[model samples]
Target chain A: MAAAVETASHIRAARRGSIRGSRRKALFWSYFFLVLFVVIFLAPPFYMLITSLKSSGEISAQVNPWWVFHPTLENYLGLLTEPNFVTFFRNSAVVSLCVVAISMLISVPAAFALARMKFWGSATLATGVFLTYLIPESLLFIPFFRIFAFLRDITGIEFLNHWWVLIIVYPTLSVPFCTWILISYFASIPKELDEAALIDGAGYIQMLTKIFIPVALPGIIAATIFAFTVAWADFLYPLAFTTSADQLVLPVGIVTTLIKGDVYNWGQIMAGSLICAAPPLIIYAFLMDYYIAGLTAGATKG
Target chain B: MAEAVMSGVRAPAARRSSLRAIARRKPMIAFMMALPLILLILLLVVYPALYSIHLATLNRSMKRFVGFGNFLFLFKRDTFWMVVKQSVIFACTAVFFKTLIGIFLANFVHTIPTKGQRKWRGMLMVSWVIPTAISSITWFWLFDPSYSAFNWLLAKFFGTAPIPWLGEPLWARFCVILVNIWAGTPFFMIMYLAALKSVPEQLYEAAAIDGANWWQRLWYVTLPMMRNIISITVLFSLIVTFANFDIVRILTNGGPVDQTQIFATWAFQVGIQGNDIPLGASVSLFMFPILGVSAYFILRGVRRRSQEI
Candidate 1:
């Protein structure tokens, strides 16, 4: 009881003294590290920007490396005009967008059911869904490759080196995690809200469309962003599956097309790497709150 | 008291619920909602995982059953055990540093003012959100032998020759670990920071009033409060790092005499590069024990925590 009284008084004193001498020191330290941390985090992309602005001769000059003699936008313009780079970006965008759409269609309702419903195997299935997220794509790639080969044999339609191949593969990553988060977010909502809607003679589909989706907008956005970023930035699947220039995603295309046999085009490679990283970086910079919310949703549920 | 009486008056008229109507219909609705998820898991996840098991057992490359020959062949290889050792080393070391650094960073971030805290929080999360493949490419450039900025900086600062980050065996392993730490630690930091916020301020205030030093307060109050969270985060990191593929793949491609090869990359090499699918399956199967143990602990921890709550 004395400890409790002392604690209450101490808290009051701390609140009173928050504007006093030692607090400023703490504030300064916090801001100082915050700035330093920001710089450390942001430096690589800054270095990439500088590298992208330099010419190949400048980049490899063996002189003072940090400063460019002649800053040029030539690499950026040249890369934009490069026929294969454009195709790669377009293919990546299309594949990523389609994967997002597909993941949402499957995951949102499934997450809702697991979160809100009580079925015989619902809980077990939820765990099963999360376990799929844990299966590394590296392990699955060879089997998937063989399955595609078999598909070609039976259907006389080749799935290899096709952009649409990702539409089939990307779901393997997105759905499980998306379902997991959606389930968590869905569970947090009050049951009475849904019950009221049900009592109003709203069908399951209508209630989902009208209520749950709107309420869970942040979680949905997080899942969509995750799917887009994963599909956009995937390397192994594209490296293993797609052989053609036209079919490649940004990550694989930049590496394969730019790096020739025993020779590295340092300028174009850095430039392409920067370009590929930009969208996700920009999105992350702006939408970090929603992203963190989405990420920790799983931790809470698990 | 007045509001309680008012609500009680309205409660009786709203009690027209039929038990059978509610019980039978709700189960049907729940099942209907869950159908797509069940089908997807069965078709996509269960089938593929089970199919891989069957593939692991047999040597049916040309529709022929070679029995346990694949496992026998894998057991006889020298590199298989080396890969296992390296994977455990990589996962343990990376998870250890990531969890430690993450906790420290989270504590540092948590003590800051709210307005400043959010900005730093967002900045730190960039490492986690910047698609792993794209950032791995950037790291590849940093470790590039000829024109790497990191090597350039190291040379300028230390007055030493440029380090062959990707070409040397031990250095290549270290570089991958560094890159993995860079990419992964933010995930733990965020989780810990969220856990930190849930801790009540009164606990700290009480410790302060008792004349406990900062370290003692942390040991007594913070550690006890965040212990479960720390374990969960570490276990999660262990599973992820054990199965990691992209960073090692992009950075080294498991080269420099295969010095840095972990299980996933080794599996890829054997299966895809060496054209030995059965051997690859055996190598990939090695990941099961690590994941299985971590998953069991995580689930049990989760259950204990849930029951406590």
Candidate 2:
């Protein structure tokens, strides 16, 4: 009777074991595809890295394109030492920084007022802010040309090709979206904190500067990062306006300078792109939480 | 402590005005705060947009008034029709694939253990972190005819002939759309993952207890939960993808007999490069109607949510 009971218990244990084994198999397959996608997603940038490490002569038709035979710092160093690389880097840095500052200055208070303060047409204006974010830069550059010409016709400030003009044009893109994102963010904060201050006899300006701005810092960081990335990554405006090499931003500068006259310097071109991509990549790497928070908040809520 | 608190309390009677006075002041205060932003939008966006419409009405030299003349000329061109078709195909196909692949990838990543989730998310987001122009440049080299990495692999493994990724017309369009999907999929992945996280775990457990299978649970619970996010993400991506210029410009530049030209590039070519600003403005203005419809929905959503707040 004891042996029979033991055998029955053993059978139950074996059945449970098989179910666990199947679950393990399911997980193995799931991870298999996950790693597969990781490789696929990473391939292009990985290819750039390997190609950038290779010697110029080694990137020919016959060589194995997968690995670098003679890994060298030439591509990266050569890019840095290129005549206008420093200028491009500096220009991008200045523009991105200035755009971020300008975007924050304009967007923060506006978003606060729109989110919290009641006014006639504030809702309409908030909707309009979101609408402007939808307007593509593609439509704007043509009119930018005409507008600059019109400015030249009147104010005589030939706005085209001037690097600072981007400082002006980029805010149109950044402000509406940044303000929209902040509106959502500022709206998310509990009303009692500010209401408490209002009861404490805090004036509106004091509440905004001392309370709202301090509280909405995360959204501000997100907007700053977004504006910086847009400024750094912008191609068309710089391309359309800034033809001179010194005035160009990194993305535009790298393309026009590195890929010259059909004799493509694949090595330097790859390296240049990698460098051009570095600022945003570094910001994304370090502050990914804030970045995603901003993107989704801007999308889902705003 | 009582004295300190009392000092703070006494200021309200001196500072807190009556309700009607505060109500009167609120609009004035809000308007003052919003003035800088409003001025920036008007000067940069509204004024320039109005100027584009005016420019579209004039001749090439900006000297003659020619109503609908630029639009008439664009309608007559075969290339313009080609751009219209290609733009639609590119935006639709790219957005569709990105959404599909994003859902799959997001679901897969969501199922993994929490410890591994953050690392994988960071890795996946790297694609989006890199600028599109930079990544597209990398792809341009990968699609290079002679030293193409993709071709080299196909030849080595499958004994396939060298494929001209950017040389032929169809392949060129494919290359541009493919790069767009690669860059954009990460965005959808992360956003959907966030939405997936918000789904109540109890609902899934309840569905399972009711004997619903995986597909049934996804259909009945997950899809219903994620409906709003899916539509908005699609609309947002559609506008951006439809107006895309960088990837195509870098990869193909409307080449192989203008088969790949979208409105943006074609406009840049004619208006900026070809020195016909009026025609270019007209081409860009065509994007407004399609995008205006999409924007209306998004703005309505934003306005509704703000009202809720």
Name the top DockQ candidate: 2
For model 1 chain B, the run of ten residues with the poorest summed lDDT: B1-10
Fnat for each model: 0.40, 0.61
Clashing pairs in 1: none
Q: By TM-score, who's the top model here? A: 2
lDDT (10s digit) by residue, model 1, range A1-302: 99999999998788657534444665566577667766766666666777788888888888666666788888888899999999999998899999999899989887776676556666677777766777777667767766788789999999998988988888888888888888777766766777677677666688789998999899998888888888887877887789888899888888778886877766677788888888888888777778788987676653
How well does candidate 1 match the true structure in TM-score terms? 0.91
TM-score of candidate 1 chain B vs. the reference: 0.91
Candidate 1, superposed: residue stretches over 4 Å from native = A1-37, B1-29, B60-62
Question: Candidate 1: lDDT of A295?
Answer: 84
Q: TM-score each candidate.
A: 0.91, 0.92
lDDT of 2 by residue, A23-116 (tens): 4764676588789889989999899999888777898748789888789989998877877988988988899899999998899989888887
What does candidate 2's lDDT look like per residue over B156-228, in tens digits? Answer: 9999999999999999999999999999999999989988998999997677556565568768998788877
